[model samples]
Target: MLASQFSSRHPSTVALDTGLSLMRVAAPIIAILLVQDLFSREFDRKLHLTSLTYPRPRYQFLLGRITAIATLLLFLLIILASLLAVLTTWISYGYTQATPPDLGLPYVITVVFIALDLLVVLAIGTFIAVTSTTPSFVLIGTIGFTLVARSYSGIVALLTRDSTLVGNADTYQSSLSLLGYLLPDLAALDVRMISLYGDWQFLPDDWPLRVVSTLAYAAALFALSVWALNRKKFS
Candidate 1:
């Protein structure tokens, strides 16, 4: 009964923790690996040409795979979010001070942002997978890109803040900013604040800009992937 009481008092907190945990694990890692496997498996089995023979435009195949993978990730997120809603509702009902569970707009929007973020990761992974000769290379390259993309914002921030360097800070900052524009800023797509705060007030004022930037980055990566796949010659 003590555990139940604890849950009752902390359901929202628990739900917030769950959402962040799920996003951290699902968005940048598991989803990327799964998407990478889509193309890696084709190459591994030497079925690239055969797979391409399906009655569709070249880009159709790529779009279809991306859509399918994104849909699967969305489905998983829905399932997890639903379970969290149910658990939070059940637990919070017993406590007098507990705020009612809200898996509504805030929760749903967070899931959408996560889905979009995973879409970008999928594009990057797909590009790496199509360009790589082996599955190992695909996995390694995707993971490396994921790490760099996700952390690029932080790395730039650190460099721009440090004044101990002998170089002119303005020049360093401008260069870093230019480099950042080219790098995928995964940090922008993060919506964890909504999960924790039960509202969008905690989100940055430029959240929409972040979403637009992420989509643009995804589009560019996808274009590159299509170009690479078209040029790729399979044995």
Candidate 2:
């Protein structure tokens, strides 16, 4: 359905754009499930107790679980990015766009940013898994986190552009702006336009800040998860 909407554009560009968009949604769900399985299920089935019996410190166990989940996500992202690249290339074999889509560095950067975005989701999921008593909260909390973190920036921008759009635009913008500090703006990490249009103009001026913010947010959540796990009791 989405492909048909983009039928007027370059097929390869459309394919890459649509594929990455779908991935932006799918990756978080996959990461949530992986974190749930790694952390939540272990607690649920009492397997965590056996793992805790090892000589290693609780932090090591938590870190090891995080590492394993991150490695799997990286592997999956690589495979999907490679497949998308190949598919895009194949589609563009004979045809040519007025402005050729960049399948080079731009595409690679887009994929990397997407991976970073997924890492934020993974971190949140891991945090919830460690901190929450209910296994179901891990899924629900992470999904809610992703939705708000990804869209809040856009919502705030809309409210800013037209204050009359809302009855209490000032209050809402102030609230979301405060949240902007607390949440990593995952929307800014979206660099798909750079790849889709092969235009440097689409490159975010504050990309370095965005990258740092993402890493810092994920690292903070991870540290909190480690802290929670170290103190967690399996009753």
Residue ranges of candidate 1 with Cα displaced over 4 Å: 1-11, 94-102, 155-179
* TM-score for all models, in order of appearance: 0.79, 0.96
Candidate 2 off by > 4 Å: 1-6
Please write out the lDDT profile of model 2 over residues 66-136, one tens digit for every residue: 89989999999999888888888887775677887898999999999999999999899999999988889
* Model 2 lDDT, residue 104, Cα: 92
Please give the CA lDDT of all the candidate structures. 0.71, 0.89
In model 2, the Cα lDDT at residue 207 comes to 94
Candidate 1 local distance difference test against the native: 0.71
lDDT of 2: 0.89
lDDT of 1 by residue, 104-191 (tens): 7877777777777677778888888878777777667777776767776775677667856636766766766776767767766676
